[model samples]
Target: MQITLPRIGTVAAWRQQVRKLAAAGIDPQAVIWSVGAAAPDLFATAAPAPGVATPLMLSLEAVDGIEMALLHSDPERFSRAHALVLRLSKREVRWGDRSDPLMRRLLDQQKAVGREIHKMHGFVRFREVSPPGANRRAFAAWFEPDHPVLEAAAPFFARRFGDMDWLIATPTLTARCEAGEMRIEETEARQPPPKDAAEELWRVYFASIFNPARLMVKAMKSHMPQKYWKNLPEADLIPDLIRSAETRVRAMHDPSAPAPETLPGGRMRKKLR
Candidate 1:
């Protein structure tokens, strides 16, 4: 049987379909799963009607793991999740068993999705997009995640920016929050938000807070990957900050070093003399 699921609400659709298949005692190998509008399998048989028996019941942990794994970018995630669920329901395999390759892969995928969600929460930068004299401020951001994670990550933004109207656009989907209501829709294209005046102040603040003595390029890169740097306003200063870190550190240690000169706007400038 061929099951084509929509890109949006994929997890819910898959869950409903899996319940029916499980109730009908359908083998995982007998079903073909595809997302979006894909060509149908010409030779595949129709899905059997759901039986009177109750659908498979799994532990909450297993259900959460499968849902998270399905959010991964892997095209085969649906099929793998279905197979794992069947195995789990039949008591053929145990959950979180590293010895089982399928279980291990799904667990790893779940972790990857979790990491992506974390990155999305920390990395999304909103630019003011509100028009003149607007009642509530509006902002927009563009993000490209490795996985289709906007659905899972958007709730954080809604809670964080509940007072304002905002839109976060991704490659596959867009999350919009207006009047405290949040909704997700398919994205037409990848278009970044326009630069705003506040970004300059943000860049200045970022540079001011940077501590040369605590600089760790490797650690910084690990926390803030280069892939996301392009979208950040402060990232433009990173290269120069790294280049001058050694000199700044030496200045901090030198007993005879000249005191820093204070400039307008409360900024600091070092004197050569």
Candidate 2:
């Protein structure tokens, strides 16, 4: 039997199909699983009718793990998940048992999906896309993730930027929030959004918060990977900031250095005597 699943709501679709196949006593290896639009398989047969209603009896942990692992970009993810689900339902394999290779692989993939979600939350940079004088401000962002994580990661943005209208576009899909309602649709454009006026202010604020005396190159790179730098407005200043960190730190320690003049409101002037 051959099963082709739509990209959106894939987890729900897979669950429904797998239940029927399991009830029919079909082997996971005997079925061909393809996601999105694909050429029809020549030798594919019609799916078997479910023989009887049998509860899968999967634990909450197992269900969550399977759902997260399915979001991974690996083409074999569906088959592997299906196999694991069968084993789990039959009590043939224990959840979180590193002794089983299949269980271990699924666990690792689940963690990978989680890490990708974290990166998406931290890295997406939005720019204003709404025209001036618009009643509600709108913004847009472009992100490329290692996994199919837009569904998993978009809710964080909705809660954080609830007052404004925004959209996040990825290669496969786009998530848009308008009037407090969020919708997911096919991507309209592959290119990143245009730069807006506020980016300069964001860059300046980034520079101001940079602490040269406490610079840690490796740590910074770990938190913000190089792949995401191109999309960030503050990333352009990183090279210069890193190069000058030592000099700035030295100046801070040098007692002979001229004291910066204090301006009104306790702000220090940038110019030094």
Candidate 3:
């Protein structure tokens, strides 16, 4: 899908993008549609529903979760014209300055990009790859993101780990970044990933840090839910974490409480854990 910001001549540009896609054998229906709040009256009138391909756009503040998606089932199947269309569209939509109205619009576009990446970052699970003499590490994650951002999301891995090789496969795209280069491919499903012990430790830490007595259950569920629990070790501990809050609070505040267990030097003998 192509995402764009509102520019001075966006209407003409939008028309050109569709035409460009058509010329390259891309079914307009196949592209996921995304756009910006500043789009002209013609396209900025409605919000697209999840999984549906429609014009997605956003204001700067709302950029957190908004996008303009034009869905294409066949990504990476570009011919010469299709590739050229993408190149041309990117050049036209490039940002110039932070202060300019155009730049602000682009920032909104990029924030939508960031939010898209973040959603994948949260949902994509990494699996361990066991091999005898592998130089590059391998992991696997599965996600059915409601939006199309796999093309833009791969770079996040590069930024997070510039020296390693990795593969992030999505239903629509399979991305690999190694030896300072990144690429994407179209693929179907693959094998499930293996587990990691380190991830379990991290999940335990996450669950430990959360104080359940402060729970806003509704708000907490809004950010996370049972469906994602299996992938998150902390999720299992949430119930326990929540139950312990009241007892922990009362123990610390009880006026008649005895002194805490301490060591010889007068330091608390308690483990942070």
In order, candidate lDDTs are: 0.86, 0.85, 0.50
lDDT of 1 by residue, 1-273 (tens): 889998889899999988877777777777888888989778788864444443576899999999999999998898899889988877889889979999999999999999999999998989999999999999999998999999999999999899999999998899999999999998986889899987777688777888989998999999999999888887887887776677677778996866454343234456787
Sort by TM-score, best first. 1, 2, 3
lDDT of 3 at 201: 62
Q: Candidate 1: which pairs clash?
A: none
The pairs that clash in candidate 2 are none
Off by over 4 Å in 3: 1-17, 20-68, 71-114, 225-227, 255-273
- Which candidate model has the greater lDDT, 1 or 3? 1
- Residue 234 CA error for candidate 3 (Å)? 3.0
lDDT preference between candidates 1 and 2, better one: 1
- Candidate 1, position 76, lDDT: 88
| Residue 35 lDDT in candidate 1 | 83
Residue range 1-273, candidate 3, lDDT tens digits:
444623223334555665545445454334544343423445432333323222322234322221222221222212222333333344543323445444454445545556556767775666665366888665556555544567656677778866766677665567777676877766566544566765666565575566645777778876665555666544655665565555556657874544234233222222342
Instruction: Single out the weakest 10-residue window by summed lDDT for candidate 1.
Output: 259-268
What tens digits encode model 2's per-residue C-alpha lDDT throughout 173-251?
9999999999998897998999988777668777788888889999999888898888888788788778767666666
Evaluation by lDDT, superior candidate among 2 and 3: 2
Q: Which 10 successive residues of model 2 have the least lDDT summed?
A: 261-270
